[model samples]
Target: MLELLDLLWTFFKIGLFTFGGGYAMIPLITESVVAKGWLETSQLIDFIAISESTPGPFAINIATFVGFNQAGILGSIFATLGVVLPSFIIIVIVAKAFSKFATNKFVLGFLRGVKPVVVGIIFSVAVSFILQNVFSFSFKELGDFIFKWSTIIIFIVVFAMTRIWKKIHPIFIVLVSGIMGLIIYGLIL
Candidate 1:
């Protein structure tokens, strides 16, 4: 019971304070989960990858993944509800109240300021992921960056495919990447 409540509160704070989408929320989620000893950095990275690839919203998926790992299905429920509730409530309120402030200078100014910060946060997270996953660079220790050939190969192939076949669906790319992973990691190495 206590764990469930903690999960709810932690995720609630994360959801309420996060201005951007899931990519931007990674830092907060990683910090909170790591501080609580609920997950290691690598595990969190894996969860992020899985969440981004899966069907549902990334925030919901991550919350559920963390929650389930902590306290089973009920934890997943509480975490998901906690993360989603704030957005739902805020959207409802904003929908009702926004018309009056739609043109207000203060509101407009606040939103304008937030846009760039969100982009920066997302960009930082993406760079961190690439550095860690592809180059095996550990930001914590400032370790020497080691090139991960398997990952680099996959990245290049997927990137080239996307650039060359602009019309191809994302799922096909994911499928190809998965096969490549299997071949590279499973069979070759």
Candidate 2:
């Protein structure tokens, strides 16, 4: 149907244009999906959190979540295909050519140039998420910014735990954070 193709094309463009990774692709994804009225910013945030926390590749999970939420199981298939196809094709082409051009100055320069852009995008996404969660900043408004005290408390505790315990694993931190969220937001506020 028209909707399925739209889903496929939207994510196809996203996957093709997305240079970095899931984090780097966040801004583009937000613009595309939110502009299309496919998902609200808050709902997209939830999908983002779910995608990050769950197992499997981040981009695929997010694409699938958006597709499923927008349509259904079939939509997930189309969207996932759209997102993966570009990379699959590009990697195949690059793998074939990269060896021959591995030492070429142009290729090397292009790769070098992309690294900083990717880092910047990821860094911006991190700061944006922190602002949204910790400072309650939203895309919809400029004023009425309020501090999220409970989230800030959780953030500080988790940050301190990470710094204090160098041996701690990331998965454990995520689990603890999730539990803390449940306790603070779900129960005691």
Candidate 3:
């Protein structure tokens, strides 16, 4: 009961404050969930991957996943609703007022300024994820320890395959990566 309410309120606040969609919301979610001890950083990373692979908005997907992990189906419903409600209400209000502010210079200027800020926020989230998961900043000697070539090769191959093999579904790429990782791990161990 109280836990459900907490889930709803927390996700609602996240949705309300997060601008520019999922990537932009990552930092805020990390602070709220990971820093606050609601979830671990590894759990957040898994949520991110699952969210990206699922349908609908990435932010909503993530919110629902986290909520479901915490308190099952009902929690997922509440969290999803909380995450989407603000966007729905804001869109409705903006639509109703569009005529009045359609040609306002101030509005235009604000929109222009917002674009770069949103890009910056998304970029920062990407950097954080890379540092946390891919590169741990532990490379003391450049020659002694190089970047993980296997991961780099996988990335390049996947990128190339996606561009060239237009008919292949993204899920296939994910599955292949998983299999490759297992095989590599088995050989290494």
Candidate 4:
């Protein structure tokens, strides 16, 4: 159907243009999904959280969720296929020529240039997420920043935990955080 085709084309565009994967693709995915009226910003954020917490690649998880929400099982299939197809084809071609370009200065330079861009993209996404979840600004009154203290506290704790316990697995941190959320938001507040 036409709906399936549209889903395929839209996700195809998203997958083809995005680089660095997952977090880096957040802005693009958010914009496209919101513009298409598939999901609201808050819902997208929730979806992102769910996607990150679950298994598989973030981008693929998001595509599957969005597609399933829009149309159902077949929609999920089409959207997933559309998003993955470009990378599949590109990888196949690149693999064939990788040996030839492996020592090429141009390829090396291009990859080096991409590293900083990916970092910037991921940093921007992180900042946006912090702004949305942890800060509220009153721009009319000289841009006063109001903090969501609990979320800020949690962020600090998790950050410190990671830095302090480098050997600890992330799943443990996630589990602890969930328990903290339940205690803080459910029981305390």
Candidate 2: which stretches are off by over 4 Å?
165-170
To one decimal, what is the Cα RMSD in angstroms of model 3 from the true structure?
A: 4.0
lDDT scores in order: 0.86, 0.84, 0.75, 0.80
lDDT of 2 at 129: 82
Candidate 1 vs candidate 3: which has greater TM-score? 1
Best by TM-score: 1
Q: C-alpha displacement of 67 in model 2, angstroms? A: 1.7
Per-residue C-alpha lDDT of model 2 across residues 30-126, encoded as one tens digit per residue:
8898889988777877776676567888779877988898789999999899999999998888887887678888988997998898898888877
Q: Mind giving the per-residue lDDT tens digits that candidate 1 earns over 1-189?
A: 999999999999989878867777888887797789988888887666676567988889888988999999999999999899999998888897787768889988988998898898888888888888788886787999887779999999898999999998656876798899999999999
Model 4, runs deviating above 4 Å: 104-106, 137-144
Model 2 TM-score on a 0 to 1 scale: 0.85
What TM-score fits each model? 0.87, 0.85, 0.76, 0.85
Candidate 2 clashes between residue pairs 3 or more apart in a chain or in different chains? none
User: Candidate 3: global Cα-lDDT?
Assistant: 0.75
